[model samples]
Target: MTASYVAIVLLGAFAGGFVNGLAGFGTGLVALGIWLHVIDPLYGAPLVAICSVAGQLQTLPAIWHAVNIRRLLPMLVGGVLGIPVGILLLGHMAPDLFRLSLGLFLIAFAIFMMFNRSLPAMRWGSKKTEGMVGFCGGILGGLAGLSGPLPTIWVTLKRWEKDERRSVFQMFNLTILACVAISHLAIDGITVAFSQLVLIALPGTFVGAFAGIRLYRRLNDHRYNLLVLIMLAISGITLVVSEIG
Candidate 1:
């Protein structure tokens, strides 16, 4: 790619990564719009996914204690079941439907979480429910290469403490990214085009992650969620606009 394209992708990665690090889900939403201006949308999915996988790896260490097996285990269990179906369905999905579906989900979920802000406060699920959440997450992950929102919504529904809620979210998404990275690689095959962009995205992701972590320390998560919700709405609107145009 040309140096100008590389610069744009990296700038998106920087902002996407930081927002994700601090807020937990908007990295792809933020980056996708920016990157779409530079690259074909097909390549855009995997390209953004790769950058996110890299940044989440960096965050795994920083939030070491935040790892809760209760949350992770259930989601992972559900994810394994959900991924294959999602992959199969994705192969048949029209690009427009996929884009619109994801956009709508983000918009609705963001709005609900912003106003609702309520969840169960206990480990209140059977193995069946946990697996169901993971199944939903995995399907979304396989489809879009990003689907941590379902599981995050699940935890939010449970009313966990704010720190626990955020921790579970980061770790769960990190896991979803890991799963999506593998699926994307297997399904799409690695391309030099993505590799070249990923090289540039790496540094930008780092820059964003550092900024996000700094902000994480300062803001309580209610504020954090509100900020991210607004971003999600903006990102979703842009995607729809892009499609319409």
Candidate 2:
């Protein structure tokens, strides 16, 4: 790779890692934008998958105890089931419209949270209902390579503790991204280029993640919630602008 390419990839990884470590999501949003400038998305996408997984692994130990398996299982199952459909829709759908709508929804939710001190508790008749939410997330993941927004919104509305909410964000994203990565590899075999790109990006990913976790530890519950809401707002605005531009 050229020096410029190396620079872009590492910068993207560092930014993505920091965002993921601090918020437990948005790695793709940060990194893909940079990587796309130098690499075909076909390869850059897989690189994102690998880097995101690495970022999550770095933070797993800190939040392991906070994960709620009972709640997460349904979403995982649903997401897995929905992946095929999302893949099918990838080339068929108007991705910009879909992303724009999702972005608006997220911004609206953040606004609602700002006004309402307590969000109404979300209830489902069965785990399957929650899993259905995961299914939708997975479909979006397959369609646009974005699977976290829906789940993040759902978890946020549930009024979970900061760490608990983060556990879901990290694990849920890791699983979905892993699934997408495998699908991509199965269709297009891995090459030395992919390996090299991942290796080069690892250092930036680790360094940023380390710094992010430190920042995360310093935030109280109120600050944590505010940060999450702000991140969501920023992500929503980013999505809209990216599509429009």
Q: Which number leads on TM-score?
A: 2
Give the range of the ten consecutive residues with the poorest summed lDDT in model 2: 117-126
TM-score list, all predictions = 0.83, 0.92
Instruction: State each model's CA lDDT, in order.
Output: 0.73, 0.85
Task: Give residue 57's lDDT in candidate 1 (0 to 100).
Answer: 72
Evaluated at residue 238, the lDDT of candidate 1 is 62
Clashes of each: 10, 0
lDDT of prediction 1 = 0.73
- Please, what are the lDDT tens digits per residue for candidate 1 over residues 64-143? 67677865787787786677777788769886877777778778877877776664255678877878887888887777
Compose the digit string of candidate 2's lDDT tens values, residues 35-120: 88887777877888888889899988889999888878999989988899998887788888988998888888888887886756
Q: How far is candidate 2 from the true structure (C-alpha RMSD, Å)?
A: 1.8
- Model 1, stretches more than 4 Å misplaced? 91-106, 117-123, 231-245
Show model 2 residue runs off by greater than 4 Å.
120-125
